[model samples]
Target: MNPYEIKELSPTGVLAEMGVEQGDLLLSINGRSVVDELDIRFLGGEEEILVEIQKPDGEIWELEIEKESDEPLGLHCDGGTLGIRRCRNNCVFCFIDQMPPGMRDTLYIKDDDERLSFLQGNYVTLTNLSEALKRRIVDYHIMPINISIHTTDPELRCKMLGNRFAGSILEDLAFFSEHHIQMNGQIVMCPGYNDGEALKKTLEDVMAFYPWLQSLSVVPVGLSSYREGLPALYPVDAQKAAETLDIIREAQDKMLAQYGVRFVFPSDEFFLLAGQDLPGEDYYGDFSQLENGVGMMTDFKAGLRDALAGRTPKSKGSHRFGIITGVLAKGFMEACAGAIEKVYPGADIGVLPIKNNHFGPSITVSGLVTGGDIVAQIPKENEIETYFIPENMVRYGTEDFLDDMTLGALSQALGAEVAIVPVRGDALAEAVAQRLIGG
Candidate 1:
C-alpha cells in the first residue's frame, strides 16, 4: 500500500460501525475525490455526508453518515502523501539547496504546492498558479493562504526566484485581491537586494489591497555553511537587522494609523540579532504571522507569564531539571526557569543552551536545534535529573529531530529521561506541575 493508503481504524469506533475496516482505501467523501488531507477536512465538515470506500478486493462501498458538521470520521491514514507534488522553482535563497549531502531523502524535496499551504501551513510562492488552479482555489474559498512574496518588483522577484515566470507575483496577488482572498505574505530580506527602498515599495504595494493582505512578515535570509557554489548572499548582520527593523517600525506605524493594525512585522530574529527589544504582546494582534517567527517569543513569554500567574509552584522534594533550548532563546528560557523555581523554592532548574552545531550559528532558533547538538552540549555536571525539550524541536506529532535523531537516541546519549514539553505555556505549566509539584 502507498503512504496515503488507509491502513487502520480505531477499534469499536466510527469507521467500524459503518463496516469500514483496515486496508480499505478511502476514495471520496461526499462524492468528491480525496486528493490530500486538506480534502478530508474540507469535505468531512458536513453534517450529513456520503463516503466511498474501495475494498482490497476491488469492490466499492458507499456509506452515509450523520454527525455534527465538524466531527471527524476516525481513520488512521498516512500522515503525508507518498506522491506529493514538488516545487518547480530553484530560488536563490532556497534552504534545501544549501543542505549538504547525507540527510534523509525527504529533507531534500522542495514542495511549493498550494494545498500544503491550506492544509499544513506551508508557504507557497504562487508561481505554479495557473488560471484553472486559481479558479479552483477561489472556488474552494481557501482563507488566509500563506504566500512567499519576496518583493513587488516583478523583475527582481524573477531574479530572486530564478524563473522568468516568477516575476508574476504581483499579478497573481492582484488576482487573489480581486477575489478578496485573505493572505499572509513572507519576505526573506536580502542585504543590498530587497531591503530598504524595495521593502518600502513592496509594503506600500501590498497595503494598497487593504485587509485582503492580512499581514506581511519580513524575515532576514539565513546563510548556511553549506552554501558553497550558491549565490554570495551575506547574512543579515546586527547593523542590517537594526536597519530593517527601523524600516518595519516606520511602515508599521503608518499601517497601524491607516488600518488600526500592524500590517507588517519583522521576524523575532531581527530584534534578537539587532540587540533591539521585541514589541510587547499587544503589538501582535492574534499573531497572524506567528508561524513565520514574527512575534513568537513575545507571544510565548506573555502566554507563559499569564499561565504562571497565581499558579503555585511546589517542590515535593529536592529536584533538579534541565531545559534545553537554542542559544538565541537561552535568555528567555532561563527567565522561564527562574519563574518556575519561584513556586518550588527548593527545586533547582538549569537552562541548557545548545549552540546550533548542525546548522550554522546564523540559524539560531530553538525549533532548528538538532538532537545531536543537545546530546553533545548537555553536560553531566549540571546534574540534570530530567531534561525538558520543546516539542517543536522534534517533528510534528513525532519524537524525531530535523537531523533525523530520535528522542530515544538523545535520552540514551544524555543518560536522562526526556520530557517533550509542549510549546504552549499552559500545557507546559500543566506538564511541569504534574511532573514536579505532584511528584
Candidate 2:
C-alpha cells in the first residue's frame, strides 16, 4: 500500500470517481502508485480499477468496484504530484522576481508546469518542454495549450526567457501547428523590447498559423520593487500603451478581414494605462483566452452587472465597506463602487487605491499587491467596520502578501475585520452583502 491510498466505495467509472472520498488519501490505481494528477490522467480511464484508500483517522480502506463505461467518479484533491514544477527561467520582467521578500513560499515559487496549464489554465513557456512531454501532449490529445510566446524573434525570446532553449519557441510552435494542437498565445510587451514594429511582426508571424492559433493576448510588462540588478526593462507608458493598442487594433482588423476573426486583443492593463475605455464584450469573440487577461475586464463588467441585477436592491442595515485595489484598477473600482452604492443606499463604499510601496510605485496589478502595501494603505481609524480585500493579493494558506506582509498582522494592525473577496465579479456583490448583514 502506498502512503497516499484511497478506496472507491462507489465507482462512477471515471478516473476521479473510482472510489476516493472527501477525506481519503489515494494510494494507487491498479498496480501503479498515483504519483501526480498528470500521471493519473496519463493512465487514462480503466475498465476495471484496483483502488486502495487510506482514511484520515489512521484507517485504511480498500475496495474494488466495477462500473459502466466513461462514468465520472466524483472526487477532488488539492495535492498535485506533491510538488509544483518551479520555473528555471529568470526573465527580467518576471513578476515573481519583483516580489518583496517574506511572503508565503508558495507565492515566491514560480511554476512552469504544463499540468498546471491543463488543470488550472496557467500559462507555460514551451522552452522547458522535453521531447517525451511534447510527445505525451500530442498522444494525450491535450487541446488548447496556453503558451507564453513573448516574442517571435528567437534572439529576443532567449533574452526574455533567460534560457538558451527559449529560442525554440518558433520550432515548438511549428510542431504544435503541425500536430494540430489548439493553442492560445501571449506576449508580455516591454516598452522597447517587443513593442511597436517588433510587436506587429510577431502578430503577423503568429497569424500565419491562425485557426490553429486560437487567440493572442498582449499584456504590458509588470515592474516591481525587486527590479534592481535585472536587465534594464522599462514599463509601458501611456504613449506606448496607445501605440501598442493601435498596432493590435490594426492586426485585429486584418485578421478579421481575411481570417474572419479578430485573433489579437490587448489586455485591460493597456487600456487602463492609456486611460482608455475597455472594449465592449462583443469585441472579445468567444473569450477563449480570458484567463490570460484577455477579455477579463469585459467579462468582469458583464458578471458584475448580472450580479447587480440579481441583487434585492435593498440593504437590511447600514454598512460601510472599503474595497482595496491597485492604482491600475482605480477607475474600475470607482465605477463598481458607484453601482454598489446605488443598490444599497447609505452603503458607504470607498475604493482605496494602495500605492505599490512593496513593489515600488511601478507595480499596478492587484495580484502583486503585498500585505505591507495594504497595511500602509488601509485607514486605521476609518469608521468602516470591514476592510474588503481582493483574494487575488494573497496566496492560499499563507499570511504573507506579494511583498511579504502577513494578512493576520495586517488585520491586527488595522483593528478591523478583513474579508478576502475572490476575483470573480459575480461573487463580489454577494460578499459585500454578507459583510453588511454580518453573515
Candidate 3:
C-alpha cells in the first residue's frame, strides 16, 4: 500500500506540535494502513493513537500520541480525498446515457462510489461494491449512506441495471441494516417497468428495513431526447405519475401507522405531472430528501412566505426585472413573482420560461436548463434591467453552464446584467426587494 504523503500541517494541531512536517509520509494509524481521508477519519477517532510516519531522510518514526477523540491531526495528505469509483452498471434509465454528445467530458462520468454517498449524499447502487469495501464501510461505521434502489425484486433489478451482480441489492442493504448503518434510498421510477404493482412490492419489501433505512424518495425517470439506440423507456405521464403517487401514499400511510414517521415520499415532479397540490410542511418532516426534489416546491413556497412576511413593503419604483426558469416551473415562479409584486408593486418582474432545446422538451428542470437555451429563447426587444437565474443553472463552484457558456458570455449576449440567485424562495424575494428598494 502507498503511504499518504503529507502536503501540509495545521500549525496548532497535535501533529505539527509533535514536529510532524510537510514532505513526511503517514504510514499507518494504530497499525491500520492509512489510504484516504476516510481511513484518517475512522482510525484517528481514538483518544490515543500510535501513528507511524516516514521522514524525508528515510527515518521511520513511531509516535505515541494522545489527544481529544474529536480533535483532527490536521495532516493534509496528497490525494487525501477519496478517489472516485466509476460506475460499472449500465442502467436503462441512466441520465448520462441520454446526454447528447459533445459536451463537457466530466458530465458523462457515472460515479457509483460509496465514499461519495457517505460524504456528498450522492446515491449509489451497491452493484460495484466489493466485499472488502463493504467490510471497510462496516468497520468504519459509515452511517447514512445513500443508495439508489430501483426495485427489490432481484431479477428485475438485475435486468434494469444490466448487471447480473445487481441482484444482491437486498442482501447488501440487509447487511448494512444488520450492522446498524443508517441509510437513505432512492428509486428512479420508470413507467411500465417499476411502477404500479412492481413499485408497491418494492416499497413493501424495503419497509422491512425501516428506521435503519430512514427514508426513501421516488423520482420519475428522466428521459432525455438523445435516446436514439438506448432502451425504449417510457416517461411517467400524468396518469402514471398519479398511479405512482397513489402507491407511495399507501406505503407512507402504513409506515406512519407502524413507525410513526412517513418512510416514503414522491418527488415534486410527480405532483406537478398529476395536477395535484403539494403537501404542506408537516408532510415533509424536516425535508431530509429535499436534494432529491422531494417537497422542494413546498419548502420554497414556505420560505418565500416567511421572507415576505418579515419584510416591509418597499416604496413604488419602476425597476423592470426578469426571472428565468424552466417550462415546468414557469407558473409556480409567476405566482411567486406576483406575490412579491403585491407587496412591492413598483417593480415589474416578468417570468420567462426557457424551453430545453439542448436536452429536448421532455427534460424540463431548471438545473438542466442551458445558457444557450436562455439566450436563444429571450426576446431581443425586452427592456428588462436585470435577469435573475437560479444558481443551479450554472455548474457548481463556477458560472459556466453545462454547454460551456460562461456567465459573462451570457450577460454579453443578452446585453443585460445577469445575477445568479440561490434556489431558495427567500433569496429570490431578497434579490427583487433589494433591487426594488435600491438597496
Candidate 4:
C-alpha cells in the first residue's frame, strides 16, 4: 500500500496553519508511516505530533504541532478511506455470490476490511486480518469493530466460509477481548447449515465472550432468485423462524437476568416470517441493532409517536401522499402514513409495496428493491403528488438506486415528486410534515 498523500486540505485546518498543501504526500506522524486513514486518525490523536510531508516539487517538509488530543488534524481524503480490501472468502451464504451479472460494479465489490468496519460500520470476517493489522487495531483502540463470525465451531466456520483459514473466528474474538477492544458480531444463519444445534452452540460460545462481544445480530441468509447454479439454501420458514425465535427468547431471558441486556437479537424478518409479534422497546436496549432490523419497527413507531407529539400540522390541504416500501415494512409505512392521515383526515395517502423483481421475491427488503421493479410494480391507482420512499431503497449516500437508476429518472417516469425518507424517526416526521402538510 502506498503512503496516503494529502489529496485535499481544509482551508481552516491545523495542517493549513502548518503550511501543508494539497498534493503534499503524507509520509509519517511521529515516525509512524501514514498508510491508511486509521493510521492518521490514531496517531494524530496525540497532543504532540511530527508531520512529514513531501511536496510535488520533491521537497521534504517536517512540521511539529502541539494541540488538544481530540482536535482533528483537519485533512480530508477520498471518502476518508485508506483503501478498500476486497473479501477473499467464498462463503456459502455470501450475498454477492448470489447476484446476477451485469449490474453496477460497486454492487459486486465485497469488502472485508477492518478499516471499513471501524469507519463505515461494515462487518469483516476476520479471515483477512493480518497479525500486523490486528496489532494496529488493538494498539489504536479501535473500539466497536463489527465482525462477521458466522459460527464458533472451527470446522463448521471453515465449511461455512469455504476458506480453511476462516476457522480462527473464536481466536480472533479472544484476541480482541484480551486487548479490551469492543466488538459487535453478525451471523448470517443459513437455515439447515447454521440453524438448530449449530445455532445453539454458536450462540452459547459467542455469549461466553461477555461484555467484549457487545452484541451479536442473527439475520437469515438472503438468497435472491438470481442464483442459477449456486448451492441450495433453505429460506427461514415459519417453523424455522419460530424455532430460532424460541432460542433467542430463551437466551434473552438468561441475558436479562445476567447482564440486563439481550446480547443476541434475531432480525425483524425472522419475527415477521414466524408470524410472531415483535417484542417491545425494552427488549432492545439502545436499539443498537436497528440496521439489522432487530428493533426497527419498535424504534420507528416509537419515533413516530414522538414525532406526532404536541404540534399538529394545522395546515390542512387534502394532500394525498403514498409511501413506497417493501413487503416487510408495509405495516410500519402504513402506520407512518396514518400519522399524517390523522392530521388531515381527507389527505389521500397510499402505501405502495414494491416487490423486488431485480433480485426476486426472496429479497424482500426495501434496500434490495430496484428502480425498475418499483417503476413497474407501482399501482397506477395509487396516485399521489409526492411519494415518500425509504432512503434505504437507494444507494448509500447517493441518489442512485440498486439498478443504477437515479431518483430523478424514477420521478420523471412516475410524473410525481419522490421524497427520500431516511431511516430515522425525526427525519421521516419532518419530511412528511414539510412535504404533505406544507409546514
Error of 3 at 298 (Å): 0.3
Model 2 worst lDDT run, 10 consecutive residues: 1-10
Cα error, residue 214 of model 3, in Å, equals 0.7
The list of candidate 1 runs beyond 4 A from truth reads 1-82, 311-314
By lDDT rank, best first, the candidates go: 3, 4, 1, 2
Maximum-TM-score candidate:
3
Q: Which candidate is the best by lDDT?
A: 3
Report the C-alpha displacement of residue 210, candidate 3, in angstroms. 0.9
lDDT of 1 by residue, 99-177 (tens): 7678889889999988888878889898887796688778778877899999999999988888888988878888999
Compare candidates 2 and 4 on TM-score and give the better one.
Answer: 4
Per-residue CA lDDT of candidate 2, range 335-367, in tens? 888887787775888888888877688877777
Per-residue lDDT tens digits for candidate 3, residues 1-439, read 6788898889988999988999998999999999887888889989999999999999999999998999998877777334578899989999999899999899998999998888788999998898998999999999789999999999999999999989888898899999999999999998878888999999999999998999999999998899998999988899998988888989999999998999899999999999998899999998999999999889999998998895666664678889999988988999999988887878899999988999999999899999999989996678998999999899989999999999999899888989999989899888987887854
Whichever of 1 and 2 has more lDDT, that candidate is 1
Off by over 4 Å in 2: 1-36, 48-83, 310-317, 397-400, 403-409, 435-439
In model 4, what is the error at residue 327, expressed in angstroms? 1.4
lDDT of 3 at 147: 95
Task: Tell me each candidate's TM-score.
Answer: 0.87, 0.83, 0.96, 0.94
As a whole number from 0 to 100, the lDDT of residue 6 in candidate 1 is 82
Order of candidate numbers by TM-score, starting with the best: 3, 4, 1, 2
Instruction: State the displacement of the C-alpha of residue 354, model 2, in Å, after optimal TM-score superposition.
Output: 0.6
